[model samples]
Target: MSAFLRSCRRIFWALAAFSGMSNLLMLTGSFFMLQVYDRVLPGRSIPTLIALMALATVLYLFQGGLDLVRSRISGRVGRYLDEKLSIRVFDALVRMPLKTRADGDGLQPLRDLDQVRGFLSGGGPTALFDLPWMPIYLGVCFLFHFWIGVTALVGAVVLVGITMLTETRTRGPARASSRLAVSRSALAIEGRRNAEVLQAMGMRRQAALRWREVNVKYLAANERASDVANGLGGISKVFRSILQSLVLAVGAVLVINQESTAGIIIAGSILTARALAPVELAIANWKGFVAARQSGQRLDQLLKILPCEEERLALPAPGETLVVEHLYVGAPNAERPTLSEVSFALRRGQAVGIIGPSGSGKSTLARALVGVWPSVRGRIRLDNAALEHWASDALGRHIGYLPQDVELFEGSIAANIARFDVHATAAAVLEASRAAGAHDLILSLPDAYSTKIGEGGMTLSAGQRQRIGLARAFYGKPFLVVLDEPSSNLDSEGEEALTQAILNVRCRGGIVVVVAHRPKALEGVDHVLVLGDGRVQSFGKREEVLNRVLRNPVPLKVVAEGPGGGR
Candidate 1:
C-alpha cells in the first residue's frame, strides 16, 4: 500500500503544477481591469482596449484548459487509487467475518474505500490544493496596498478558523455517520436475506421497527454533520461578500483622499477576493475532506492488521496424505477454542466420517480442515507441506469444500457445478454432476446446463442447491474433499448419490472427510472419528469406534436408524 501511494507522487506533483499555472493565469481578469480603466479608457485607445481583451481572452483560455486538465487528472487519480486498493478492500471484506462476529463492521472497509475515492474525484482535492496559496493571494493583495492586504488577511484568518471549526465539529459526527451507515446497511441486508422467515412469522413490522431505530441514528449523525457544514459554509459565503464590500468601502475612502486610483481599487478588491476564496472553498468541502481522512485512517488500520496475503511457493497437488497435528480451532475472537487437541492423519484413497452430537465442533473441525478458520496452535499438512506453504488459490484448486449452508452464486447450473471456472470443460462439468447425482436434476431444469440458479440458488430447492454444491466439491477431481453435513438436506436418492460420490472420490486416490450425524452418510467410510465436546473421544475403524462409543454410557448423539431420524 505504501509503495502504491509513493507511485502516486508524480501524479500529485503534476496536479500541483497545473494548479499553480491555473492560479497564475487567474490574474488575467484583475490585470485586464487595471489595464482597461487606467490605460485604455483614459487614453481613449480602442487598439489598446482590443489588445487587452485579446490577451485576457487568451489567458482565460489557458486557465480553463489547465483547470480542466487538473480536474480530469484528479478523477484519474481517484480511479488509480481504486484500481490499486479496491481488490484489497474486497479481500478484506470477504475475510472480515472470519476475523470477528461484529455485524456492525459489515462492509465498512468497502465503504471507506468508496468515501476516499469519491472525495478525490470530486471538488475536494481542488480545494485542498488551492488552500496552500492563501498566503500568495494575500501577498498579491499587499502589492496593491497594505490596508487591503490586512483586510484580506483578516478575512482569511476568520475563514481558516471556520475551516478548523468545521473540521472539529464535523469530524466526530462524520465518523459516527459512517459507522451508523454500516449498521444500517447490515440491518437492511439481513432483513432482505431473512425476508421469508420474517414474513412467515409475521414479524415484518417488528423487523421494520428495528431497522427504523438504526436508520434514525444514521440520519441523526448525518444531519448533525450536514447542519454544521452548511451553516459554516453559509457564513463563509456571506462573509466573503461582506469582505468584498468593505474592501470597496476602504477603496472609496482612499479615492476620496487621492491615495489610490479607480484601477487600484478594483484590482485590490479582486485580489482580496481571490485570496480568501480557498478558505471558503475549504469550508464548503470540509465535510467530505474530513470523511475522507477518517476513511483513510480506517483503511490503514484494517490493512495493517490483515495485510495482503504473502506470496507463497506453489506446491504440487496433494495426493499422498492429509495430516493434522494437535489442531486447536475456534471461531475468531472466541472466548475459548471450539475444537482442541485434534490430531488425525489420512492417506490418499481413504474416507473418514466424523460422528458427533450437535455443538460437538464437527463443523468447526471441517472448516479448519479446509482452511476456513486459522488454527490457534497446530499445523495441517498436505503431502508433508504445511497448508500455508501453498498459495490460497492454488490450494483451493486441489481442495473440495461443501459448506453446511450451500450458498450459490447467481449463474447457470453448469456454472455453479463447475465452480464458475471459466475454462471448465463440458465433459468435466458432466462428470462432476453425474458423480454428485445431479445430472438428471440438471436435465430436468428449464434450461438444463444453461439454467440460471439465481442468487444463493434461491430459485432452486434446498436439496437441489445442496446437490449442486456437492457437484462443485467434486469438480476438477480435488484431492482432498471435506463435506460438512453433506446429507443434511438430501433425500434418499440424493443421499445414495452422495454416498456414491464419496466412494468415487476414494477410488480416485483422494481423501474425503464427511462431517455427519446420520449413519447413512457414513455408509462409504472405512473409518470414523468420534468427537465429544470438541475433543476426540475415539478414532478408528467405523465398526470399532461405534461399538466403543455405544458401550460408553454417555455416548455422543449416535442414534438408531428410523423414520425422521437417520436414512
Candidate 2:
C-alpha cells in the first residue's frame, strides 16, 4: 500500500510547497494593520500608506493563487488514488472466497475507496497540512509582547486537549456507525434483488420490517457520533472566541502600562486567531477524519489478500481433456465436503451425464469442473496443467459454463451472447446463437438480436433466459462446457434444441458435462456418473450403469426410462 501511494509523491510534494507559501502569506492582514497603525498614522504619511497597501495587494493575490493551486493538486491526488486502487479492489472482490463474499456486502470496498478519495480532496487534509504552521504564528506573536504570546500558547494547548477529547469520545461510535451502514446497505440490496419473490409470497412487509431493524441501529449509531462531535465542536468554538478576546484584553493592559504600542495590540489579536484556526477546523472535521482512517485500514487489508500479479509463461490452449485426481470440494464454510474423493477423466468428443437427486452433489461437481469453486483436496487439471497454474484470463477462454441460476446483464442480446467483448464480430455471435438453436427465436423478437434486456434478463421468460444462457455458453467454441440443470425450464422444443446442441459439441470434439435430474435430458450420453451423499455411487458406460442401477434396488433413486418407456 505504501508503494502504491508513492506513485503520487510528486503531487504530494507540490501540495506541501504550495501550502507552505500560502501559510507564510497568511500574515499579510496583520502586517498591513501593523504598518498602518505604527508608521502611516503616527507619521501622517499618505504616500507610505499607499505604497504599503499596493504591496499587500500583490501578496494577497499570490496567496490566493497558491491556495487554488494546492486545491487542484489535492484533486489530482484523489484521482491518482482511485486510478491505482479501483481495479485492484474490483479484482479482490471477484476473487474473494464465497463464504466471505456472502457474509458481507461486496460493494463495501468500492465505497471505502470512494470515502478515501473524497477525504483527500476535501478540507480535512488541508487543515492537517496547515496545522504544522500554527507554531510559526505563535512565535511571531511573542515578538509583540510576552503576555500575548503566553495567552495564545495556553489557548492552543486547551484547544488541542479538546480535539483529543472529541476523538476519544466519538471514535467508537463512528466506527460502529460505519459498520452498521455497510450492513444496512447489504440488506437493502438483497431485499431489492429478491423483491419479486417477497411480493409474490406476501412477505414484503416482513422483509421491510427486518430491514428497518438494521436501519434503525445504523441511525442510532450515527446520531450518537454526531451528538458527541457537535458538542465538542461547540465547546472548541466558544473557547476560541474567548481566547481571541482575551488576547486583545492582555494586549490592551500592556499598552496601558506604556510597554507596547497600539499596533502591537491589534496585530497580536490577529496573529493569535490565525494560530488557533487550524485546531478548531480539525475538531470540527474529526468525524470525517476517523471515517477516512477506518476506510484506509480496510482497503489495506483488502490489498493484502489480493493475489499479486506475476510474469507467468503463457501455456498452450488446452484441448478437450479434463482430469480430476481424487478431487474433494465443499461449500463455503461447510464442515463436510459436498463432493468427496470424486475422480474422473474425460477425453475429447465425449459427453458425460451426471445424475442424482437434489442436493446430491451433481451441481457441486459441475462447479468444480468449471473452476467456479475451489477444491479442498486434490486437483483438477486440464491437459496435464493444474487449474490454478493457468492464468485466469487465459484459462477462461477455453471454458464455458451455464449455472443453474441464470443471470444476464442489462444490454443488447448480441452483446450478452458475445460475452460483452467489444471486439466480437456479429457473425461469431450469430453462429453461437445458431448452435444453441436460439437464432430463430431471437429473430422472432421485435428487435431481433438488438433487443434490450433488463437486469438478470427479467424481461424474458424463464425458458427464453435459459436458451440465451445456453447460447452464451456455446460462444467462443470453448474446449469444455458444463451445464447445470439446463433443461429445468425448457419445453419439449427447447429440450430438443438442447439435445442437438450437446451433439454438436461432441461432433466438434469438445468435452460436454451435463448435470441433470431429468433422465430424458441424458439421452445419447456416452458415460454416466451417479452420485449420492457426496460420494460417487457408480461410474461406467451409460447403458451398463443404467442397467445395474435399474436391476438392483438401492437406496439411491435412479431416474431412467422404465420398461414401458415411461419415466
Candidate 3:
C-alpha cells in the first residue's frame, strides 16, 4: 500500500501547488469590488471603470482556468490510486476465503478501494486543498479594518465548530451504515446464488423477509448519517450567509465613525465569504470524507494481513512422485483438524482411490493433495520440493482438481476445457476433451465446442458440467489429478467415461487421486486408501486394503462391499 501511495506522491505535490495558485487567484473578485466601489464610483471616472472591468474579467478567466486544471488533476490522481492498488486488492479478495472464515461478504475490500478512489477523484480534495488558505483570507480582512476583521474571525470560529460537530455526530452512523451495507450485500449475493433452492423449496417469501430485515437496518443507519451531515451542512450554509451580511453591517458602522470607506463594506463581505467557503464545502462533504477514510484504513489493513506472495526460484516440473508426511488438514478456521496423522505416497503412473465413511476426511485429504487446504502439521511434496515452494500459478499448471460441486465457469466448451487459457491450442483442447470422454458428447451439442454455457454453466445438465470439469482437469496433461465424487452425477455411461479418464491419466504416467463413495469410481485405480474417523484405517494394493477394510464389517458406504468390488 505504501509503495502504491508513493507512486502518486509527485502527483499530490503537483495538485497542492495547483491548489495554492488557484486559491490565491480567488481574491480577484474581492479586489475588484474594492476598486469599483472606492476609486471608480467615488471619482466618477467612466474610463477607469471600464479598464477596471476589463482587468477583472481577465483575472477571473485565469482563475477559472486554474480551477479546471486542478479538478482534472484531482480526478487523475484518484484513477492513479485505483490503477496502482486494484491488482493487490483483487488478489486479496481471491485468497481471503481460503485463508479464513472472516470477510463474510468477501467484497468489502473492493468496496473500500472504490470508496477511497471516488472520494480522491471528486471535489472533496479541492476543499481540503483550499482549506489552508482560510488564514490568508482572514489576514486580508484584518487589513480592511479592526471591526470588520473581528467579525470575520468570529464567523470563521463558529463555522469551524459546526464542521467539527458534523464530524462528531456523523462518525458512528457512517461506520454503522458501512457495516450494514456489507451485510446487505452479502445477503443479496447468497440469495442470488441460491435462488433456485429458495424457489424450489418455497423459501422465496422467507428469503424476501430476511432480506427486508437486513435492508431496513441498513436504511436506518444510512438515513441517520445523511440527516446529521446534511442538517449541519445546511446550518453551516445559512450561518455563512448571516456572517457575510454581518460583516457588511460592521463595515457600515466603521464608515459612520470615519474609520473606513463605503468600499470597505462590500470588500469585507466578499472577503468573509471567500474565506469561509472551504468550511462550508467541508461540512457538505463530511460523510464521504469519513467513509473514504474508513475504507482506506480497512484496505490498508487487508493488504498487510494478506501480503502478496514473494517470487520463488523456478523449479523444474515434477513428474516423479507425490508424498505426504504426517499430514493434518482442517477446514478454514475450523477448531480441529479434519484429517489428522494421515500420510501417503504415490508414484508416477499410479492411481489411488480414497474411500471413507461420511465425515471421515476423504474430501479433506483430496483438498490437501491438491494444495487447496493448508496442512496444520505436515508437508506435501512433489518430487523433492514442498508443495508450497512452487508459485501458485505454476503449481496449478502442473496439478488438476475437480471438487464435489463441479463449478464450471461461464465460457465455451473449448474454453472451459482449456481452463480459459488465452494461448490454449485447438489440439490440446480436443485431446483433453477426448481423454475425458467428452469429445463425442460435446459434438452432439448444437454449437459443439463453441456452445456458450451460461453463468456457472447453468445451461448444461449436471452430468454435462461434470464431464466438462473433468476435461478441464485433464487439460495440459497435468502431473497430478484429484477428483472428489467424480461420478456423483454421472449415469452408467458417464461413470464408464470417468473410469477411462482415470486410466488415461495413469497410462500417461500422471498420478491420479480419486475421492469416491461409489464403488464404480475405483475400478481404474491401482491402489486404495481407506479412512475412518479422520484416521487412516488401511492403505495398500487395492485387494489388500479392501479385504482388510471389509473385515471390520462396518458396511462402509464409501467403498465396495467386497475386495475392490470382487475384482
Candidate 4:
C-alpha cells in the first residue's frame, strides 16, 4: 500500500503546494474588509480605496487560479491511482484462493478501487487537505485580539470533536452496509448467470426471497449509517453558525473596552467561519471518507495476500517431460485431501488416460497439473523446474487445460480458439481449429470465423461448445495438455474428432492426459492410470493396466461402467 501511495506522491505534493497558496490568498477578502473599515472609511480617501479594490481583484484571481490547479492535480492523482492499482487488483482476483473466490464477491475489489478513486477525485480529499490550514486562520484571529482568538479556537475544537463523534457513531454501520452491498451485488450477478436454471426449475421465487433477505439487511445498515451521519451534519452546521456569531459577539466586547476596532469584529467573524469550514465539510462528507478508508484497507489486505510476482530467471519453455511426485491436493479449505500421494510421469509422445470413479480426484489431478489449484504437498515439475518456479503467463503458453465444465467467452469462434489473444495470427487460429476438428463446424456458420458468439457460448450447442473448448486446449501446439471429460458433451462424430485430436497431439510429441469415463475414449493411449477413492489403483502401460483392471473386475467397476457407477 505504501508503495502504491509513493507512486502518486508527487501529485499529492503538488496538490498540497497549491492548497497552501490558495488558503494564503483566501485572506485577501478579510484583509480588504479590514482596510476599508480601519483606514479607507476613516480617511475618506477615494484614491486609496480604489487602489485597495484593484489589488483585491488581482489577489482573488490568483486565488481562483490556485484552486483550479489544486483541483486538477487531485484529479490526476485519482487517475494515477486507478492506472496503478486496477491491473494489480485484477491480478489479485485471478490469483485469489479458490475458497475465497467462491465465498465472496470476486468483483468487490474493483468496486472498492473505484470508490477510492472517486473520493480522491471528488471534494472529500480536498476537504482533508484544507483541514490542516484551519489553524492558520485561527492564528490570524489571534493576531486581531486574544478573546477573538480564544473564541475561534474553541469553536474549531468543538467542530473537530463533532466530526470525530460522527465517525465513531457511523463506522460500524457504514462497514456493515458496505459488506451487505457487496453481497447483494454478488447475488445479483449469480442470479443473472444462473437465470435459466432458476426459471426452468421454478426457483425464481425462492431466489427472490433470498435476495430480499439480503436487501433488507443492507437497507437497515445503510439507513443506520445515513441517520447517524445526517444527524451529525445537522449538529455541525448549527454549531458552526453559532460559532461564527459568537466570534462577532466576543469581538464586540473587545470594541466596547476600546481593545479593538469595529473592523476587527467583522474580520474576526469571517476568519472564524473560514477556520471551521473544513471541519464542517469533513463532517458532511464523512460517509465518503469512511467508505474510502474501508476501500483502502480492503485493497491493502488483498494486495498483501496476493503477492506480486518476484523477478526470477526465466526458465526454459517446458518440453514433453512432466512429473508429479507425492502430490496431495484438496479443495481449498477442505478437511481432507482430494488426491493423496498422487505421482506420475509422462514423456514426449505419451498419451495417458485417467479413469476414475466420481469424486476419485481425476479432475483434481488435472487442475493440479495445470497449476489452477495449488498442491497440499510435494511438487509438479516440468523439465526439472518446479511448476511454481516458472512464471505463470510464460508457463501457460506451453500448457493447455480443458476442465469438465466447458465454457466459452463472448467472441467469434476463431477468437475463442485463439484464447482471445489479440496478437494471435489468423493462420495459427485456423490451424488449432482444424486440429480440434472444429474447423468444419465453424465454417458452417454464416460468418465462419467472424461469427460472434453469445456469452458462455449460449448460441452454440453443447457439442459445439465442447469442441470449441478442445480447440482452445489445443491452441499454440502446447507441450502438455490436460483434458477432463473433454468428450462428455460430444456426439459420436465429435468424439471421433476428439480422439483424432489426442492422437495428433501425441504424434507431434506433446504429452496428453485425458480423464475419461467411457472405454472408447481411452483407445490409442500409451499409458493408463486408474484411480479409486483418490488413490491410484493401477498405473502402467495401456495394455497392462487395462488387463489388470479387467482381471480384477471389482476394482475396475469404475472404469468399466463409468464414473458414477461405483462409490
Candidate closest to the true structure, highest lDDT: 3
Instruction: List, residue by residue over 1-567, the lDDT tens digit for candidate 4.
Output: 568778767777878888888888889888888999999999999999999999999999999998888888778878988888899988988777653544556778888999999988888878998999999999999999988999999988888899999999999999999989988988888899899999999999999999999999999999999999999899888988988888888888889999999999988888888888989989988899999999999899989877788877888777759999999988877788999998889998899999866778888888889988888998999888988898888889999888887888888888888998999999998889898999999999889988888988888888888888888999999999998887777777877888899999999999999888877678758899988888888899998888888788564533434334211
Q: TM-scores of all models?
A: 0.97, 0.96, 0.96, 0.96
Q: Choose the strongest candidate by TM-score.
A: 1
Cα lDDT tens digits for candidate 1, 1-567: 455668999898999999988888888888888888789878999998988889899999999999999999999989999999999888888887778775674778888888889999999989888888889888988887788888888988888888889988998888889888988888888889999999999999998999899899999999999999999899999999999999988888888998878898898888888888888888888888888888888888888877889888767778899999999988999999999999999999999998777788888988888888989999999999988778888999999999888899998888888888899999999999998999998899899999998877899998899998999999999999999888888889998999999999999899999888778899989999988888998998989988888888885756534212111
Q: lDDT (0-100) at residue 451 of candidate 2?
A: 95
State each model's CA lDDT, in order. Answer: 0.87, 0.85, 0.88, 0.86
In model 2, pairs of residues that clash are none
Better of 1 and 3 by lDDT: 3
**In candidate 1, which residue ranges exceed 4 Å CA deviation?**
1-3, 560-567
**Stretches of candidate 3 above 4 Å error?**
554-567
Clashes of each: 0, 0, 0, 0
Error of 3 at 99 (Å): 0.8
Please give the distance, in angstroms, between residue 217's alpha carbon in candidate 4 and its true position after superposition: 1.0
Clashing residue pairs, backbone N/CA/C < 3 A, model 4: none
- Quote the positional error of residue 287 for candidate 1 in Å: 0.9
TM-score for candidate 2: 0.96
Cα lDDT tens digits, model 2, 1-567, are 466667777777777788889999999999899989999999999999999999999999999999998888888788888888889888887777643544546777888889889988887778888899999999999988889989999999999999999989998998889889888988888888898899999999998898899999999999999999999899989998999899989988898999998898898899999999999999888888898888888888877866555656889988858898998998766787888899888898888988766677888888888887889999998899898887777878888898888899999999999999889998889989998989999999889999998887988998898889999999999989898888888878888888899989989989999887667678847888888888888888889988877776764555533211111
- Give me the overall lDDT of model 3: 0.88
